[model samples]
Target: MQKIAIIDYNMGNLHSVERAVSHAAAGNATVAITSDPDMILKADRVVFPGQGAARDCMRELETRGMAEVVREVIQTKPFLGICMGMQVLMQHSEENGGIECLGLYEGNVRYFGTVHQDIGVRLKIPQMGWNQVWQQMEHPLWKGIPDGARFYFVHSYYVEPQTPDLIAGSTEYGISYASAIARDNVFAIQAHPEKSADDGLKLLGNFVAWQP
Candidate 1:
């Protein structure tokens, strides 16, 4: 059986993610929420999920010595990053008054301001609701999901991948931003599949069965 490890650096909603992955797996795989680098490396797949501020997240990751572990795992396994997990994959973030990130992907995370000049409308900082995610490129994880499916989003910052081709999904809040990215064996999204219901579960199921 395949072993999937959800990296628990004390920065994510681990239990909710575990339950969601479990439901999605349907007994096809074993999921473990672990902080040990060795155990994470041993897993066939890794899920990196995070919540809270970027500075604090980075602090915890560095302090726990999980940063290098994440870098190593992403290069070799089928990896998935969620929400803040997706944010930190970039080189830097404008969050927490600007902080450096993992630099795994060439990009930066920017804040969605209180207003969008292009749309000429006042917008909320934290876009906390279901938003339409448009598929930008073909990938295995998007298998059964529709082109313009809605996913649960609760984030103020969005990623801007340096390489446009890496963007697998896009969503518009003030402006359309890269909401999901995929390259090689890495796939990350700036939404919560755990709270996204049917389509979310389908995506998670696809990940469980995905070979890349």
Candidate 2:
């Protein structure tokens, strides 16, 4: 049986993610919500999900010594990062007054400040609703999910990957930005698939079946 570990560092909505993954797996895999580094490393797949402040999240991972474990796992397995999980993968963040991040990917996370569309209409920060995602490239996680599917988003910050090729998907709040990024075995999203309804479930299901 496949083992999927949802890393629990007290920074994310762990139970909700657990439930979503369970539902998506549908008796095909064993899912565990754990903070233990060994268990996370042992799993066939790893999911890093989080919400809240980036500084607090980084501190928790360091405090629990899961940082190295996460670094190792992402290199070895089919890994998925959600929201803050994706932000932390970048080299730095403009959040928390500019903090350093995991540096796994060449990018920076920036706060969405005073967004204005082409028509000069102001959009709210923390984009707390469904937004359309345009697939930038073909990826396994995009399997069965439509080209312009809407996903649930609840964040004031977004990732800016150094290379355009790393972007798997893009979305516009006031401007277009990388909503999803993937390279090798790692795929991360700035939105919450757990809360994205049908399209989200399809993404999670794709991840469960991904060989990657």
Candidate 3:
């Protein structure tokens, strides 16, 4: 049986993610929530779930000495990143007074500040709530999920992948930003599939069966 590890760095919603992934696995694989680099390395797949500020996330990752382990996992295994987990994979972030990130791909995380697509109709920051995700490219993780599926989102910053072609999905808030990115064995999203109901569960299930 396959072993899947959810890298833990004291982020919020780790249990929800764990439960959702467990249900998704359907007894097909074993799942573990761990900070131990050896276990992560030993697992067949890894899920990087995060919440809260970028600075805090990075601090915890570095403090726990798991940043390099995360860096190593993404390149070698089927990796899934959620929310702030997705943000830190970029080159830099405009959050927490400008923080440096993992730079797994060429991108930067930017905050939504006074963005208005319509006149005088301001959208809230942290964009808390459900939003529709438009799939940008075809991939196994998106299998059985509609092209424009709505997912749960709660965040103030979004990612901007330098390579446009790498964007797997996008969502329109005050503006349209890369909500999901995919490359090789890595797939990351800004939405929390655990709270997304049916579509969200489907995504988790797909990830378990995803070969790439």
Give residue 49's lDDT in candidate 1 (0 to 100).
Answer: 97
Clashing pairs in 2: none
Per-model CA lDDT versus the true structure: 0.93, 0.93, 0.92
Candidate 1 residue-wise lDDT, 1-212, digit = tens: 99999999999789999999999999999999999999999999999999999999999999999999999999999999999999999999988889999999998998787236556777897999999999999999999899999999999889989999999999988788999999999999999999999999999999999997
What is the C-alpha lDDT profile of model 3 across 1-212, one tens digit per residue?
99999998998778899999999999999999998999999999999999999999999999999999999988898999999989999999988889999888998898787354434567787799999999999999999999899999999888999999989999988678899999999999999999999999999999999987
Model 3: how far is 7 from its true place, Å? 0.7
Residue 84 lDDT in model 3? 92
What TM-score does each of the candidates earn? 0.97, 0.96, 0.96
State, as a TM-score between 0 and 1, how close model 1 is to the true structure.
0.97
Q: What is the C-alpha RMSD of each candidate to the true structure, in Å?
A: 1.3, 1.7, 1.6
Clashing pairs in 3: none
Location of the lowest summed lDDT over 10 successive residues in candidate 2: 114-123
Clash count of each predicted structure: 0, 0, 0
Stronger candidate by lDDT (2 vs 3)? 2
